[model samples]
Target: MKRQQLALFIGLSLSALSATTLSTTALASQASDPQTVFSQAYQSYLAAVKADENVQQTAKLAYTSGKAVYGKSDDNTANLAINYAKAIKGYGDELNEQRFALYNEAHTILAANHGKQSIETIDALLGQANYTTSAYKAANFLEQVIDIAKTQNKPKFVADMKLEAASLLAKKFSSKKYREAKNYLEEADEYYQENLPENSLERIKADFLMASFAEGRKKYNQAIERLNRIVNVFDSNLNFDHSAELSAHSKLIGLYEKQGKSEEATKHCLAIAKMVPWKESQEQTPLYRVNPDYPLNKAKQGRSGSVAMEFEVDTAGFVKNVSILNSDGGVSFEKSAIKAVEQWRYAPKFEKGQPVSATSQVRLDFKINR
Candidate 1:
């Protein structure tokens, strides 16, 4: 998982617990020293475990202790319940039915304290989605999150959730689900355009997702357009090593091959080949390279592609004037091709033993089998 996903997961878990609490006089008195309450609950839970008491009984004691701090309507109660549930889940390698039961109990408590459609409830849903055994169930939970985000006027959040939901739906592509996934991607693109900066990573990601969605729908031209937009941004920004850029390039190559644009595809393949380190001078070689992730829709359908590009290696060994010479695929391939070439480094050509700029080309191929 990416760092962003992990952060979002943690945030959602905390938000779910925090937002569900309802204030009451009893809660206020207990909340005066929440730390003490949490500590007592932990100690009791540890003691119960040490004594080898009934696991469910010990879990209940922990839950009760947490509730004493802020009543049943407190975030601390949810947090304690979640912790105990995790402990139970990790207690043994065998399937622990009690763990899910406890998780459901915590979720029910949160929903009862808050409203079913509340952000708190959505958070719990996200947690369930993360831990659930069923992909369909997870997709449904993400859809709910998207709906809640829409109602709250959180366009960025809506886009984020929609992207996640679309990805899930795309993974399980059927005639119906593919259409649904495309719709989600389209909606996410709208939100991204309205709420995010043109060069924002989130917007780039949206474009990547849109390209995939377009390809899945056989809207090759639209997919190309979306990918081209991503490449243009990377070219202007010069942050060519982004994973999205690589994906764009790879998809473009595949799309081109599908269209029988062999010449264009060959160019992209050459452009990728140029990315190999020119080790004539160690200092001139690329320090790092980021490969694009294969398009999920394409992977599912057993598709492949390639891209080619040209650029100038400056005296400083930095790539410059990057351009797609040809691409068999659409904008997706071109974007990634240009992006990678733009980051290429090489020993500057020598004329009379003096460093000088030189022109070069490379190709990249995207393939997968499953």
Candidate 2:
């Protein structure tokens, strides 16, 4: 077997079928069973992922032939539907409707075959939750999975479900859903703290969600504490930059700023500015951005305007020498834009691997209901 194909077979628990010598192209011609053809095409689809090749046709073949062989309620058909849905998602955003249809089909088949609360059904629902754009639908699916998981001896699965539920529920941001999200976060955090490594990604994700929930509820101190712990874990355990670390620092910064702790916020702003790549190496690029608040008077008039500003980023990444190039609104818009830009930080340009001050321009738009 090809090395990548063998790895995929192990992952899919299809080692027995992996021994077959038929290529996907030859499978239909050589084997009378649609099952054999579907299985080979499925393997081909997996191989395509590793090869960074598109095999949507093969994926479709897997689905159609698998359904013919195993029927709709068969576990094999359900699995094929779910995996192909995920694969189709990778093709692009254009297939979103089709992918959702596949997930819905898989969930229905799995529920019929294995009962509503079975692992297969739960997994299919989770897939739908992951792909759905609507927060309400995602939360509904995750809530179902979490409820079902509670009835089984599946602490880890239940915890995972709760964590997902917490993330989506918080997005709803209503009082009831917010409290529900908080409860779910607490449960997920407890399980992760007890069962996973302190520095594990799963634990960190739970902590991050907790931090977000805290921030949303105006509990700044609590949010800061949670984010700081995450920062410490990333620093001491990982000793490297990750997107999660950036996110923690970003949250810490806004929380500190909201609490009137400019010094602390600046510290994180600078820290974040240094973590990512700078502009083209020839231009300064923003790392810490502050959105301009709508001018109260203009907002009252239901007005909207934009101001373009040219600014100098100092060697330390602080904005300076800011000048409003032009504005479509009035002086209020220009002043607000400049105020926000003054607090912004950037990745200063580097020449010969040394930091250099550089000029950058940005247009800040102030609008209500935008």
Candidate 3:
């Protein structure tokens, strides 16, 4: 058999039929000989396909069997139709002509039986979006899903769908579409801000997209800010190996390079390189420095102080083992100093031609800029 047909057969064969609630008479008949009753319809579907019968006829039989076992408005029937359509399209032959019609028919049936705003219908729409050939059409389907979500008062779902649409729009090669993509991203951001926490995965995803938009528009500073926010969020809430943090780091390096800030780019590269063993025949140095923000309260009180911190720069160029050696400032200044220093990325130190951990001390002065 063809590859697509073989795949479809494997998928269908592995799927277990689910029992549906039925009328009393039907239930009694099903209980009497459940397997035989269901198999009769299913086997007929299989026989029709094996005999190279009409594609529609075979799909109809599959749907009939699925409904018999899983109810008219069940996901099973929709899946059967979708699978059949995908298989037909994969054939890339005369049968492919009817694939889209079959898909639309399936979605129409689902929406008719299960209300258009129902979760079942929304799921079917999402499935259709994935299966459709045109990006614009897929985005339209997602927009419809979002509209339904709004009617259902699901802000999170609306945000998720908006992000999906934005992501799709961002993939287009035309720069003209970037504006539209940005609009969608902004809408997604609004919803996310209202519904998700600062460190939530969904919000991070929005930040990533917004950063991309900024980069596309040549707003390097804005892009850098967004990328840094993503990194900070991931570093604070997720493991080191989280994909978003890695992506943010990579993007930051690229953006810094574009801005001709080779030193900044190199710092991030060294940080990532710490993941592997490397040899450097030079002493470590500060590549980037961040000044601590003087607390407003301290400034109003006319307070000026200094904080000294000792930390270790690991092979990956990340600061760790931060200790407060001394602090003339109050707790507010000390906290700000630690937060800024922790975000610092350093150049790797070399000992005997190999990168190794090194300890260092630094003092930060916090004073109100009168």
Candidate 4:
């Protein structure tokens, strides 16, 4: 199996275990020593995790004690701020200004203490990347890390940074951005071939990004070739990421559909049905949606309404038996919703490693252009 790699994202989460921790108890007794208090706080946090209890209290204690012990402007203090931020972020306060400030604090301290080019600044820059929603900005942070890794003669780190930089830049399409990202990816590919194993997930992820780049540029043939390679790899190496394989099939469907190749698209549609569905997050959700059309009569009358329908996605991943449970609109709206849903597709549920039909409920809304 390919070694698990860090998540390739702007907010590449720093490991919370970076700081030392061990047996410690009674925070009140360790109040005199901020370091001891910090350790105690982490110990309490571990118990909370094991017991599946809320971690806010212990997390706050760790933050408070960490501040006291890491008052100096140095790498240790920078890392402390990052860990504290990660703790609260786990509670779902991802967009809070305070969290971003904590990340910025780490970046500032790291730059001041170790200089901009030091390897130590990498985490802080990556931490700051989480504070921004812009893919371009996140790629910029990776670019800085690229320079730092080069300065420190860390080829592996540089390659890792480039891989992520390419992924982020692939989020949008622009001729200039594509060219720049391609360069980063090409070099990273070279490093991966020489260093990482043949089946490295990171290398596969890099290929995925390159495929996305091709898709963005409307280079459909190139994108299909790359995605097919990923699918083939997973076929031989069952340990590979199945989601990426499903995603490859999904991408192939879109690419083929754009070229009016229904047979090719259905091949993927059937492929998805044979595989288990991904539901842990929307990131892995496949889109074969066929939107309901607005009725012309409703549009001319400036009427808007919704239709609630229940349907089954058969083992073949085709929508069937779309029954309207309710509707605020007229029969026209109901008919449109049914027609559209019948064309929709899904990754049918699997049981005992076998494809199974599944039912779904949906509310399709239709609004006239205002």
Best by lDDT: 2
**Reference-based lDDT, each prediction:** 0.60, 0.71, 0.66, 0.69
**Alpha carbon lDDT at 314, candidate 3:** 76
CA deviation > 4 Å runs, candidate 4: 1-36, 46-57, 90-96, 133-140, 169-183, 190-198, 277-287, 309-315, 320-326, 348-362, 368-370
Give one digit per residue, the lDDT tens place, for model 1 in 16-129. Answer: 113332121122223345545644555555566556566545666657665675466555566556656654534432434455555566677767877667776665665565
For residues 21-97, what per-residue lDDT tens digits would candidate 3 score against the true structure? 21111111243244346545555555665675665556566555555665555555565666566445345434544
TM-score of 2: 0.77
For model 2, the superposed segments whose C-alpha errors exceed 4 Å read 1-29, 33-40, 55-58, 90-97, 129-140, 172-176, 239-241, 277-288, 293-305, 327-332, 347-356, 366-370
Ranking by TM-score: 2, 4, 3, 1
Worst 10 residues of 3 by lDDT: 10-19
**Candidate 2 lDDT, tens digit per residue, 1-370?**
2111111111211112123232322223245566567667766776775575775666677778877866767666776676677556354455776787888898998788778887657767866775676767877887788888888887987887787777756654445467677788899899999999887667777777777777777999988998998888977866544777888888887787677776677666656666665656454546556788888999989999999889888766678999988889799998888888897765555566566778888888776775
For candidate 4, which ten residues in a row score worst on lDDT? 1-10
Please tell me which model should have the higher TM-score, number 1 or number 2: 2
Model 2 residue 351 CA deviation (Å) reads 7.2
- Which sequence of candidate numbers ranks them by lDDT, best first? 2, 4, 3, 1
Which residue runs does candidate 1 get wrong by more than 4 Å?
A: 1-9, 12-74, 80-106, 130-136, 172-176, 270-370
Question: TM-scores across all candidates?
Answer: 0.50, 0.77, 0.53, 0.75
Candidate 3 segments whose C-alpha is farther than 4 A from its true place: 1-75, 80-105, 172-177, 276-370
Clashing pairs in 4: none
Model 4 TM: 0.75
